[model samples]
Target: MTRRCGFAAVIGAPNAGKSTLTNRLVGAKVSIVTQKVQTTRFPVRGVALADEAQIVLVDTPGIFQPRRRLDRAMVRSAWGGAEDADAVVHLVDAPAQLGDSPADRRAQADVETIIAGLKASGKAAILALNKVDAVKREALLGVSAALYETGAYDEAFMISASTGSGVDDLKAKLAERMPEGEWLYPEDQTADLPARLLAAEITREKLYLRVHEELPYSAAVETTAFQERKDGGVRIEQTIYVERESQRPIILGKGGQTLKWIGQKSREDLSVILDRPVHLFLHVTVDERWADKRAFYGDLGLDYDA
Candidate 1:
C-alpha cells in the first residue's frame, strides 16, 4: 500500500479546545490544556497515524486581539501554521457562539474574524463545531448553517473534543484528504515537541494552574537543565520568571510550600509521561522584561518582532 502524509493546521480562538482535539487525534498529550485563555504560545505539531496516512496536526495558539508584543507574535504564528498546511480545521465553541453572555459574544466575534480570514485567503476549511455536547442539536444546526453559508468552509463537523465524540469520523476525513507521499515521522512517534521544551511547558502549565489569577500574564518557564541519571531517572531544573518582585513570594508561598507543591505536581506528570522517575526543581525569579527579550521568543519558535 502507498503511504500518505500531510499537514493539517487547527486554528481557533482562545479556549476553543484546539489542543484538546489535537491530543485526541494524536492519541497523546502533545499540547497542554488549562482553563485559562491564551495558554498555548507556539505551534505544536502532533503526529497521528490513520492506516497508511500520517496526519501532522499543527496546534496553533488561540487567535485574539493583540495588545502586547507576545500576543502579536502568537497570533502571527497561528496564521503561519495555516498558510503552509495541506488542510485547515477551524474549531469553534458552538455552545458559546449560541449564547448571549459577554464572553460568548467575544468568542463568536473571534470565529467570525477567522472566517473572514479564510475567505480572504481563498481557502475553504473544514469547520469543526466543538463542545457539541453542551449545545442543543437545533442550536448546533443553526450555528453550522450560518457558518457554512459564509462559503468559507467545505464541510462541518459537530464534535465534543473532551468526550471523544465525533472524533474518529473527523480523523477519517482528515486521513482521506492527506496527499499520497512518504510518511513524515516514525509510526511510533506521537509528537514532534522536544524533551526540554516539553518539560518547560509542563512546568508552565503547573504554574498557571496554581497561580493563574494571582500572577500576571508575564510568567514564563524555562528548563535550564535536563539530565539523565545512571539510575534511569531524569533530573530537571526549571526557572519560572514573573514580572514583579512581589509575585515571587506568592509563588514561593509561606515556608516555600507553594513552589514545592508546583514542583511535585510537575514531576509526577513528567514521570508518568516519560515512563521514568523525575527529580524536578523549580525556582521563581523576577524578570519584568522577560517578554521583551528576543531569546525568550526564539526559544518557543515564535518571531519576537511579530
Candidate 2:
C-alpha cells in the first residue's frame, strides 16, 4: 500500500478557531484553546492519521497586523509555516465575518489581511468557514461565496470545529491532498512539541483562564526544570514572569489563593496529559522586560530578529 505524509498549515485571524480545528483534525488536545485572541504564539505541529495518510498538522499562530516585535515574529512564523507545507488551510470564523459589531469588524479586517497575504504569495488555500453552527444558513453561504470569489481559496468547507460538525469531510480532503511520502513521526505520536514546552503551555493556559481579564499579555510561563523521580513520577518547576510589579498581585491574588489554584489546575492537566504522577511547582516573578528578552523568544521557538 502507498503511504502519504506532509504538513498542512492552518492559518487564520485571531480567535477564528484555528487551534480548535487543528485539535479536531489531530483527534487530540495537542494545541491549547481558550476564549482569547492571540493565545497561540507559535506554530504547533500535531500528527493526524487519516487512513493511509499521515497528516502533520501545523497549527500556526493567528495572523494579523503587527504593532510590536513579538507580534511581527508571530506573523512571520505563521507565514513561514505556510511556505513549507504541502497544503494550507485558511480557517475563518463565519459569524464574525458576517456580523457588524466592532470586534467582528476587527476580525473581518484580519481575514482581509490573510486574503491579501495569500494573494501576494500566489498560493491558494483550502477555505474552512468555521463556526457555521453559530450563523444562519443564508448569511453563511453569502459570506462563503464572497470569500471564495477573492480567488485566494481553491476549495471551501463549512465546519464547526468545536462541535465536530462537517469536520470529517474536511479531514478526508486534507488526507487525500497529502503527498506520497514516508511518515515524519511515529503513528502513536500526537504532537511534535517538547514535553517541557507543552507543560509550560498548559500552565500558561491555566494562568490565562484564571486571570485573563485581570492580567494583560505581559505575562508568560516557562518551565525551569523537569525531573524523573525514582518513584516513577515526574517533577516540574516553572516560573511565571510579569512585566510590572503591580500586576504580580493580580496573578498571586489575596493570600496566594489565585496562584495556588493555577498550580493545582496545571498539575491536574499535566498529570492527565502525561499519564503520570506530576509534581508541578510554580513561581511568580516580575521581569519587566521578559517580552524583549532574546531567551524568551528562543524558548518559544520564535525568531528574535524577525
Off by over 4 Å in 2: none
* Tens-digit lDDT track of model 1 for 1-306: 889999999999999999999999999989998777889999999999999999999999998888999999999999999999999999999988888998998898899889999999998999999999998889889989999999999988989999999999999999989999999898999999899999999888888888888876778999999999999999999999999999999899899998998899889989988899999988888889999999999999999989
Give TM per candidate: 0.97, 0.98
lDDT of 2 by residue, 43-68 (tens): 99999999999999999999988989
* Model 1 regions more than 4 Å off: none
State the number of backbone clashes in model 1: 0
**Backbone clash numbers for all candidates listed:** 0, 0
**What is the alpha-carbon lDDT for the whole of candidate 2?**
0.93
lDDT score, candidate 1: 0.92
Query: What 10-residue stretch in candidate 1 is worst by lDDT?
Result: 210-219
